[model samples]
Target chain A: MPPTGLEAVFLANRDKLVRFLTARGAGDAAEDLVQDLWLKVAGRMDGPIANPLAYLYRAADMLMIDRYRSRRQAELREQDWAEGQGPEAPPGTERAVAARQTAEQVAATLAGLGERTATVFRRVRVDGIAQRQVAAELGVSISTIESDLRMAAHALAALKERIG
Target chain B: MSQDRNSPMHGVDTVAIDWALRMADPARADWDAFTDWLEADPGHAERYDRAAMTLLDAEQALAAHPDVPVPIEPEPVRRRPLRWIGGAVAAALVGAIGVTAWQDRPQPYAIETAAGQTRRIPLSDGSVVTLAGLSRIELDHAEPRRAMLSRGEALFQVRHDARHPFAVQAGAVALVDLGTVFDVRLGQQTRVAVAEGAVMVDPKGAALRLDAGQAVTVEGDRLIRSTVQPDEVGGWREGRLAFDGAPLGMVAEDVSRFLAQPVTVAAAIATRPFRGTIDLEAVRHDPAVLGPLMDVKVRRVASGWTLEPRE
Candidate 1:
């Protein structure tokens, strides 16, 4: 379908990208990457592309993989930075390391949540935007937007339950 | 209704409950059309009131248990969308009252898994989740356990996390161990199969640590564990479920994914387990080839099909 809106694009890719990402490495990573993807898709120069859903999701997946690599590189850089910082700074470095790991894990998990819902949820929750304007810009009714939130909430809740 | 809005949506009307849950959630545009519809006259509001009471009761039960991670509606998401209404709804409600008056929510995770329908869920966590046929899991996670597999079997290859430890709760079985990959099922029976690392299979207060190359079947509180190769139990990860020496009923449960709803097997044949591998790609197009092999028959029932073992 033509990508008139970001919602259609995000939904089409959400399932496929989840499966695709899980298989790659970031299985249940985080909502950040997905959010990032949505933002990128929405901000893309391509106003309306062919197979918008598939193309956007593919880009998100690629971004996820890149994110993974960046994380790895950051970890290595940190390790190298620590080694160069002398043996005197041990305990302080350890705490920093732990905090970094937690943040990374959280980021990965957020990224895994994908575009549409992730963006909507984050913008509303993280940015605290009202839902009406969210719907207006996305060009959907309030009810449809509610459905997305409901679906995301149920899915996320289930995910938390299965693992926690 | 306010006092008991947390009750589980068991046997409750799906539509009203679903919408109510949506209303409670923070992500959506705050001005719910469904809520307006329900509140338009008063009859709709009453029905919503009834469902809301049950949902509230369920949430209360979940909230009582702190360790359990209840689904937290992202208020951060909710705060502004009401603003985005261009300040219409809020500007309207300002002179009126509290937030509780707003909800009209989604049915409490209205999941319907038939006896043989294997529904796969790719979670927000990036974890691949599969709900086995005839499984009915209560998506009531406002409690300690992330999910309560109320009446069926489910396999979870949990995304590893100590902070948000993945947990699968069955009646007498609670698998909340920290590990890489694991499969959990709770229905007519409770079982936990670990493909890697180790999973703590806790039945009531009893704890059993099942390591890689090990599987366990928990019937009631009894944890029956055995040493088995990880490969044997890891087939589900590949989208192919292999059943070796499983009874006909058991086999039918796994194979029913090929059908719409689960087709039941006779009580006599329920004890007759079959051994085979179900490949989605190979058999997805035609379940006919695989169904008859186990002396089972496939017949369309309503919009879906039912599997019947030849009489």
Candidate 2:
């Protein structure tokens, strides 16, 4: 059968997607990533998307993020294993200490933000509540909630940089 | 270069974060504008990726520090219009009448299984239910066509009757068999997978029809549908547990059901995604074998076993 909707769009822009992924530093895996994108689009059961092209690009971006995460996790695991075998300290102790420190830093960062921004971040991120509902509960507009989340994200980015 | 608020690059970071937040709601995202922004400059794509990664890291950090208390106000009671209140009163009166009729029906009895045990229950209507370990199911002898799985997992080979459809309720979600063999697992999320024939998930709400080699995971009000291998639906019955990017916490829960002692996962690696098949029989004898299979350190705690990240 001929492709339709998102599938059709994907087929026409397959090369463009490959270019995009390559430009985004996918390197040799650009083709494979494009294939994965095809599989995702083919398996999707949802109705027609509002912007098929943009949706495909967004999905492609997320795919890259997932790849980066798994790769980073594997590297961390290997590094930890190597470090565990060293004579400097006992195995797994450093990981626990680092985790505790990161947690403390995250808590301090949240505490340092404005009360409203911190509350909004907690309700939306920690509690998993809808931003619109949180806005309604706080007697604020959705844009206000979005702005608060942005501020929280900015603070977190700074924290991650410091931790690094 | 310094990344202070006054830096020229700070504007890019702010816009990137804003875009990331907006893109969280994919259905309503202005993707055209986002793509335009991304294509406007190569640095924009890089900044956007960092923003997205930062958000994810923040979520993980918060998850790791669950003990950190953030004061939250109690939920406010929503006030309904007078017309809606009157409608609700009438609906309650009708529900009371229905309850009176329902009270005459036979009570549903519960069937439970301990860890490392499985029970095969043959219903009166010719359907067979294979309840997994550490699971519970409620069945009514008088009405053999209905069952409720309160926890854990079960495989149902439903005998389809066009006049009397077989229905299985898992939490708020309900699955009605349409000449089907399906597996339902209840945990932090509800999962329904059809092995043979078809099933209707959430028949009263989304009413999604899933056929063979199809599955759906219901989390909150969202129903995410995906494809699954038909033969792998009840692989646990064959001493194999298959996972495809399932969180370690959920995998540990499944593994715990097959052993005399429960398997516990550390909070740090609880959300780590694992994809592989575990040999339940092998792990049952020596839980430490999970260390190699799952790339984690398995330590025998006082209670049972703990799976921690290799780190």
DockQ values for all predictions?
A: 0.04, 0.13
What TM-score does each model's chain B reach against the true chain B?
Answer: 0.51, 0.67
Global Cα lDDT for candidate 1: 0.51
Top model number, TM-score: 2
Per-candidate TM-scores read: 0.37, 0.45
CA shift of A67, model 2, Å: 48
Q: Count the backbone clashes (under 3 Å) in each candidate.
A: 78, 0
* Steric clash pairs (candidate 2): none
Q: What residue runs in model 1 are displaced by over 4 Å at the alpha carbon?
A: A1-164, B1-128, B132-145, B227-229, B232-239, B280-286, B295-311
Tens digits of per-residue lDDT for model 2, B4-46: 2223242135566666777765444765566566666656656
TM-score of chain B of 2: 0.67
Off by over 4 Å in 2: A1-164, B1-104
Root-mean-square deviation of every model: 22.6, 23.2
RMSD of 2: 23.2
Give the per-residue lDDT digits (tens) of candidate 1, residues B1-311.
12233323322233454555555543421332543454444344444444444334233333333233212321111111111211342233322322332343323463667643568766656555677656676553122225556666566666665555556656655566564567665545556676555576552244455555446665443455433334557465365776645667666555564445454565756877676677754555665666666777766565454556686
